[model samples]
Target chain A: MFDYLRYIRERNFPHIWCSGCGDGIVLKALIRAVDKLGISRDEMVMVSGIGCSSRTPGYVDINTLHTTHGRAIPFATGVKLANPKLHVIVVTGDGDATAIGGNHYIHAARRNIDLTVLLYNNYIYGMTGGQVSPTTPRGKRASTAPFGNQEPAFNISDLAEAAGASFVARGDVYHAQKLEKLIVKAVQKKGFSVVEILSPCPTAYGRRNRMAHPVKMMEWLRDQTVPVAKWERLSPEEREGKVRTGIIVDVDKVEYTETNDKLIESLKADK
Target chain B: MKKKRADNICMMQGNQACARGAMMAGCRFFAGYPITPSSEIAENLALSMPAVGGRFIQMEDEIGAMGAVIGASLTGLKSMTATSGPGFSLKQENIGYAAMAEVPCVVVNVQRGGPSTGMPTFPAQMDVQQARWGSHGDRGVIALSASSAQETFEQTIRAFNLSEKYMMPVILLVDEVVAHSTEKVVLPDPGGIELFNRKQPTESPGEYLPYRETDDGIPVLARFGTGYRYNVTGLCHDETGFPTNNPEKIEKLIRRLTDKIERHRKDITHCHKIMLEDADVAIFAYGSVARSARRAVFLCREAGIKAGLIEPTVLWPFPSDEVLETAEGVKAFVVAEMNLGQMAREVELASKCRVEVHRLNRVDGRLITPQQVVEKVREAL
Candidate 1:
């Protein structure tokens, strides 16, 4: 049994997440994954932006930076480049990662920088009172979309894969144990890795989407999500609404900081 | 860090001087986007940073560049970013974050004409008020301006020193004239200059408080990944650096964040009072316009007018005391700037109706000439 409580800031107790918010669950799985790797707490740095999931850094005891909205990835990029030895992790949400920050997200992947992005796809902007987000399913209800969201939703994992991330995976809060394992692999990958967690925002998202209870949201995850191995076997019609829950892409690439370091060294040698 | 030159005297452009001056000031991280009139600073740093064993990245946009600078600064590096008007607007949110979080860093805005990318390659002293109150919120700021390439070099170093000492972002504003003009500069020996680093906590990690108030009102920021394990946020946070909703705690945090900069205005403000000792008419200016103001002062004196120039290198914390003191002797002030009249309003407030304030305005992407200032002074008289 891992001593997860030791990793949290006890003084910040009574965490900010609502009774059934899935952010807490993602936080726990993240702690367990780091614990499994035997990494020192001091060696970890968590950077987050403004969102319900961005609050994850405040609870855990590590070098955490909660920055402005939609800028966590770039901040984390700086942190990683500043000290390549430290394992930098970015905790963000669907809107925070894909909307305002979409450019940075794609650019970081394109550069193949070493960062583990634990993106919480809650399907709505929960922190700002359940506004429509980039990941909001078409016809989903939101405060800004009371008449139902008119746009198609983004497949976040696919975006990361297309953007050239070295590692990409998806998991749900309902499968807590499996999610922890996936996070471990994403963190181990050398270049821009993304682990998109299908977390629930019970208060903001679930209530309006016909699953008001946290338990129902978890059940929705269980029923709608299929492992990628299984998902690949299903027909196109059979996979209409089902989400794939496993690694979609994993490959080796030249990490940005390593290349930067080499360039500095080569310049020094020439001098 | 390599010395600027063997003899320490060289002719360099204003942007080159700024980048080299930053190296002397121990800036180890730079992230910026390419914008006209300020792109040379980034281009110079891209070559210099790698040579000096520092880091540089051309970010995707202005906001991300500002964000990266803050993050790099938190990790105990003196980080900076340079941009122009449009980019400066995009960086305002993160600049506000640096203020609220008390992260020490530098932002250089090479003044270009703008309400919106109005003129990229030309100079304007338009961002004076914006530098002071650009970021939305009630927070005090420190901004410095330079009249020449040499002064831009020295002021860039001073900007970093003040930022580190005060634990906040310092804005270094240079106009397009100073940024692009080639001038002779005697670079100071790196060892001969003074530099200030952010205060490090002497206390153990267990006893450390990231936002604990000190005698000077500045809080010590522990570098990230150095066993401090502390949290930093833009939300109103208490001494522990965690967000709080208690009205009293929130108020205290806000006041402390602001008072740390406001209380030390004397040390942060820098200005040049040229020939103001005995003058009936004083010209108030800064940036490249200050060069023209100095010439106008000399021209006024030759023509039997007791005229002087009050050039504020530090534009914010607004030099009101200096203005008030100078206003006692001068009959009136001729405010010259490339903008319509930004600093003129500040001068009027500082003078407190003791002297009439006259304006010499220009916005056609041209530097205000000495003749224009002389005419304005004569007309006011």
Candidate 2:
């Protein structure tokens, strides 16, 4: 029998992502978080949109919904609301989370439902070739933006905090252990939670940019971020080029299904 | 099963009957957004679902509502959503996904006038073609149309049953008039209504393959929890329910999906003919338009004209044989509907051009009246 305690699909090896892709690190962090938290695979569901990062669910031994392009959040929301006994988690890529699925992402956070979203921010639309995405840095080269993109990139964790997520954090592939701790914290929260992990895309993203090698991209990711506590101490000039990577929005509020459960209980009591 | 009597007759609006029928079919989850002509369904569901120990969510948009329904259905709960034309158009992508992934859910489209939001309060059968061919890819769809408040109730339950039986999305197509009208309906006893749930995997968790085709071409469904822990995707997949790139595997999957419905054509197509005894003229129609055609058939009989009516309750997997049988020995056909000859073209093609076809179409957010149908029949004559 397949073991539910160990949250890894042992038989399905040789996953689809290319070598040096940061998706593997993020996947390991997610499994470690769930495993460390003693969450049973039977009680967990991993939903993903169509992207390279979305493929993590297949290698994990959990109920997985690989939904259409940019629809993983709504699909995950349905699973959570339908059966509150289950813990729902979502993994999405830059294009899957911010561009096509932006509405569902923001609305899911705004509703403050109990779903932990592990957003793999790989900068480029790696699944469909190196197309420019909503998070692709302005003046960066992509397949679609041959002359460099003109639009500004989205600060995803900040966007999630603004969208009313109860717990918002940023982690990077450079620090896998720290990322796992953040994921564990997010999953333990009772309301909507989001963790944007800065993952590298050596295939689609690295070849086109100046960080053509995997080490160059890894070094770049390591140099760009600071803890949120230290980030606040820096001057605007110092913070201009740095990203604040830590818990950004954490608060206590009644979750969506809990309120709905109360409504049901009141309705039942009236009868 | 107890016999349904007239004393069981209760006054029910079309949408309310639909909601009640959904509850009877074991639908414990409903996710929807408010849209006219189908809003009462959501309203009634929101009020009644919690009382029945089910959950109801008013999603952020039509697309989310559809997506949620698929998700809930993956958990092996009977789930459904109701929408009108504009909303139904938005749901096309996920409905196609449901078809591809073999997800079982029911979609109720109380069709209204549309190219885009043509009418909010008026009736039209404009989405009949869209219901049949709206989604991308070669997909299987079971779309049922009901004419009255009573049929809308029974057919909705049937829609859920068929959706589970076929493991695909079933569309219950209604119009603004049928969805809004009220009439006395004899509610079926809980024991009398037939409910068909999806076939679950008999094998234990580790040995289960979600999409492994059975002898009947349907796979056993393993719900989201319960340790099955399988993957469900929209891409053309192998028997293991994972995306496949092999051309041969894709061809087999598509052929099986297509033939699963096409091979069961008789069981899926529900149709009826009225006053067709030795008839030479046939009025072919469905949905609310069938009511006008029925009246026109009666009026023609009083005038000593041998007129008949053929209405197919199941719009998709179009009732070709039923129309061909009704068209036998008939010379002219009058297709009456609330669109620009959408179904008329189907009837014409199904009849094999043995009889000439005429359309009495109305797109001004108005239903085709009995008088209008009679005029069209006379013109065809």
Candidate 3:
């Protein structure tokens, strides 16, 4: 437990996250996952894009890059390939991953580039003062969505699965230990793995609505998520307003870098 | 120059020659996406790099390709990527980051016709301006153009040297025709060629600033594992590599980025002045078009027209002084390229005389022939 604390920058603590912001909880989960994996600090590269959740990398004491608004995946992929020994984890937000960087995220997944993407899906663009993001709920009220958001929220896990990601999981920050376990599985996965942690932005998404505190937000998450196995078992009324949580998909596939190296080697030998 | 080794001579396309040049220059990593005219580069690298103890990755896209090159470069490897027009446009942001962060890498733009996806399989030198100013802000660039397969090999080597020396990205401006066209190239042995690795700071990690300039205006870079914990950013940064809003620091940072190349103007600029000694007319060209211009100059000289050929190898920093010096005695300057008057504008800016600068351009996915260039030269005369 204390070892995990050493991986965190206490100076950056009491982070800009609000009192009830679930980003801090998600950060703890990531730290715990890294601790469990026992990967050396120097051998890990953490990349983040611009967002409330993206700030997770700054608080973590690792080889971290705070990149442009939507380029964390490419940066992380670079770090991974440059030194195949380094375990790369990209901490991105819903808006950061699925909006401007949507192309990169899908492509990275499609290549199955042995990266672990921890996407914090807060369902709104919480960093730029609560704009309507690609993952903003269709009728959610955000600063830019005064008349309620018209765009349907992205099912990011589904997108990742479709994009050939080997491992895909979703968990709510309200379920801290569960989120941590899923992250560990993601980190250990051979190919591209994504763990979408549905965290809460109390200051942005919460204050705008009635869920004003961490407790209320946790209650909302608890009410909203249904376990994947039990999803089909639920009645229509019971399934109402629930998002599926838990590992939605896991399949074996050859990773991008390794496959490319093999192909290059064979081609050279033939020549 | 030393005697060429047996392995140096290979009948290959210009793109393949580039790969061989990179290998000779000690480029250990290549990350690129397959785009037309540029695919041969990736194919050659993918086939040859690994055997030479290098690594090649076909990244998700050009954006990822650029990022991978920079990342690999940070680990103390010479790295490069090849792409065409649209992919080049996609890579602008990371290219800007590499510029501001002072990362040494090479970007090879095998030019293709495009406003957007115009001719994927055809040739155009449309990216000349984009190569200089495609990125968001003000920073100087090192660009090289090659007219033949042999020159492609030589210029690619020079691109790596400049990238490492200046700690900036070097652009190899190749076009579709040159990239895909095959020719016999004589590659020099590794021992005979001069390769440049970035100057690492001798100071202690704490005392070092990654972006800090020495008196000569080039920053010293330390590889990532060397325990030098310096920040690299796309934002305007100070000497310590930290983002700063200080007006003076911003001014100095921008000036140093540009001046590092400009101050070494004589050393960085390279061009071939053919038959300019007593010529009354000069034709300025670069890349494959220069090859055609060479033929044109030969025909003009036979016809009793004193036509010279000025082939600029260093396309950026624009060879302004050299162009001005060469244009002194000429009555007219005919700038021939495969695009709409890109290099012609530079010739006009450099010449002190009221010289008539004419442009012979081709955007029809075809090469500007020697006959066309000769006609332009005769008309200008």
Candidate number of the best TM-score: 1
Q: After superposition, how far is residue A242 of candidate 2 from its true place, in Å?
A: 1.0
> By summed lDDT, which 10 consecutive residues of candidate 2 chain B come out lowest?
B2-11
Model 3 clashing residue pairs (backbone): none
- Cα RMSD of predicted structure 3: 3.5
lDDT of 3 by residue, B1-381 (tens): 997668857799899899889988999899899888798889988877777657887876788788878877876789999999999999998998888888899999999998899999888899999989999889998889988889899999999999998899999999888888888987776699988888888998658777766888888877765666554567687886656779999999988888888899888998898999988889998888888999999999999999998898999989988888887878889998878988788889898556889889998988899999989988998
Interface RMSD measured for model 2: 0.9
Give one digit per residue, the lDDT tens place, for model 2 in B1-381.
987657667999999999999999999999999999899999999989999789899988999999999999997689999999999999999999999898999999998888897898999989998998898888767999999999999999999999999999999999999989999899878998889988877788988998886888887878888888788888888988787889999999999888899988988998878987677789988988899899999998888888898898999989989888777768789999899999999998899998999888899987788889888888888
Tell me the tens digit of each residue's lDDT in model 1 across B1-381. 975656888999999999999999999999999999999999999999988789999999999999999999998899999998899989999999999999989999999999998999999988888898899988879899999999999999999999999989999999999999999999877789999888898999999998886888888999998999899999988889999888998888778767877789888887888889988898998999999999999999999988999999999889999999999998999999999899999999999989999999999999889999999999888
For candidate 1, give the docking quality class from DockQ.
high
What is the DockQ for all candidates, taken in turn?
0.86, 0.76, 0.37
**Local distance difference test, each candidate:** 0.92, 0.90, 0.85
Worst 10 residues of 1 chain B by lDDT: B1-10
Error of 2 at A19 (Å): 2.2
Better-scoring candidate (DockQ), 1 or 3: 1
Task: Tell me which of candidates 1 and 2 scores higher on DockQ.
Answer: 1
| Residue ranges of candidate 3 with Cα displaced over 4 Å | A1-20, A210-215, A226-233, A246-253, A258-271, B1-7, B201-208, B352-354
